[model samples]
Target: MVTRIAKCTCGQLQITVEGEPLGVGVCHCFACQSRTGSVFAALAAFGPGYRVTGRATDYVRTGDQGAKFRFRFCPVCGTNLFHTEEGEDNRSVGVAVGAFADPDFPPPRDSVYDCRRHRWVQLPEGITVYDKDPE
Candidate 1:
């Protein structure tokens, strides 16, 4: 019954998520870092229980698994809001955790691509981490 609201920087996009997120995690993959323009990317998984309103543009990429990753961002402000993998249906989206603008929303419970993580950046202790993606 937890509902969270996320928005694009310029307010052109808004995503409202109902219920708890399936999971929260951090990614250190090169692609994530580049796409987010940060050392790492934090994501919250919402399973088909969210609604998105407003206009956003999309960019697509091929994942290592050959899955299509479609990124949605606000065209007006160029803020990357959320993304979905191919065949996921409307049932799921991996949202940029920061978009909520809530400092206490939640911390990542998993860390992926640790090998690619920047040396100076330390992850929270005692969660879960994978040298690469989880097996």
Candidate 2:
């Protein structure tokens, strides 16, 4: 029953994750890399009970999954806060692992789009990996 709080760099937007995440994963897809300005994007998925408050701006993008994802970010500091997929439960949310800024937060359970992962990047042993989304 660990409760975690994730906020934008400016702390204008915040997300409260109740309990543990349903899943955590890293995305190595080009889109994710570009969005995060990094080699990959780590995300923590909270269940339907999570709560997010504060101002955010969002844009829709079609993911490789063929589903549209509404990506939300903090308007003040331009931090990627959370996103929800089309046809998915609105209450369920995915937030940036960096936002939590907590070393104790859960680690990614798997790596997706591993085919696109950088050659020098090493992942932890035994964690499940997929060339693409497990879905």
All-Cα superposition RMSD per candidate? 1.2, 1.2
- Report the lDDT tens digits of candidate 2 across residue range 69-107: 999999999999899987885568898999998887777
- Give the lDDT of residue 100 in candidate 2: 90
Q: What is the lDDT of residue 82 in candidate 2?
A: 91
Total clashes in model 2, counting residue pairs 3 or more apart in sequence or in different chains: 0
Off by over 4 Å in 2: none
Per-residue lDDT of 35 in model 1: 94
Provide TM-scores for the models.
0.95, 0.95
- Which ranges in model 1 have alpha carbons more than 4 Å from their true place? none
Against the true structure, candidate 2 has what lDDT? 0.89
